[model samples]
Target: MDATPSAHAAALWVGLHLILLLVLSVLVVRQRRKHQVVLGDADIPELTQAVRAFGNATEYVPAGLVAVAVLAVAGAQPIVVHAVGLVLFAGRVAHAIGLSRSGGSSILRSAGATATWVAYILGAVALLFYAIP
Candidate 1:
């Protein structure tokens, strides 16, 4: 079986992001244990924030991973793959930090969202160019 650098690059970013997701999971667990709330967030601010952060990542990361993989497989340049990966990484981290700090809107969260969106858009457009022939 052979795999291109494109898949490898996507895997690299996916692995990194998955690691961060594990960290986010840990944060939620810690919050849960600290608050003694076994199920749900229990309406605690910290726990709620932690849960939402983790939940948000769950909602976004999987789709983003697929989009990135498709884009890479569809022949995006190596540099483009890496840049998208980096942006996704930074965006997820920043958004997590911002959410942990406050549930409300914040600069880091906003910037992180924009970066994530930009990464996806770039990947999609680049994939179109490569795929449409």
Candidate 2:
């Protein structure tokens, strides 16, 4: 089976990722504006730390998504694929927001992180099942 995505679906996926990246960039820029710090400035430790957390989230979210897309293209149930993608997207957005906020904590961040991991695991399990049968 061809793994190439339909034009509309591919556009939607690309747009979704672009939106995520753009939102992160906007958050960084807004914080910099509010604090008047260059990207390398060490004075704004909290902002710097928040940016680092965002980076960490970015790393995991996309990797999980790649697994999702691969499994989806490999014939995981379409409904499952959509549900997983939606959950992962929601988690990434929520995690990013909580991390950027001053009151963020392990609990708040963990909610989204856990959701993302579940999505990844679901995709992996589906892939494994497909491979075995």
Candidate 3:
């Protein structure tokens, strides 16, 4: 099977996601330095939130990106791959922003969580479609 298109598309979205993760990591590091937090959260609220925001991305983004890459390689439509990836990316950004601003709940946080879940489900379904035969 010709995987050139899929590879290209997967590279684009995965690279973008890496950049986003780097940005999120920087936020956590900056917050840590600002709060003089050398260890886990240092019991500081903002620092804690920053750490969790970064941590949350680590937990979700890798799996989501893998699913996306698999879908792409398995010949899923490029548009669908991109749409799901975009949702995941946007969700991570929104979630980070919302959590950074306030440790508690917010519309951005809720929307971000929802988007991430939708992306995951969509990616899984796409993979299943390709895997079925």
Candidate 1 C-alpha lDDT tens digits along 75-117: 7777778887888788888899999999999999998888888
| Cα displacement (Å) at residue 114, model 1 | 1.0
Model 3 lDDT, full chain set: 0.88
Which stretches of model 1 miss by more than 4 angstroms? none
lDDT for each residue of candidate 2 in 12-48, tens digit (9 for 90 to 100): 5546756886778676677777888776635676667
Runs in model 2 lying further than 4 Å from the true structure: 1-14, 103-107
User: What TM-score would each prediction reach against the true structure?
Assistant: 0.93, 0.76, 0.94
Better of 1 and 2 by TM-score: 1
Name the regions of candidate 3 deviating beyond 4 angstroms: 1-3
What are the per-residue Cα lDDT tens digits for candidate 3 across 1-133?
Answer: 6557767778888999899889888988998899888879878998888888999999999999998888887888788788888999999989988988999999999899999999999888888888998
Model 2 residue 82 distance off true place after TM-score fit, in angstroms:
0.9
Top of the candidates by TM-score: 3
Worst 10 residues of 3 by lDDT: 1-10
lDDT scores of the candidates, listed in order:
0.86, 0.66, 0.88
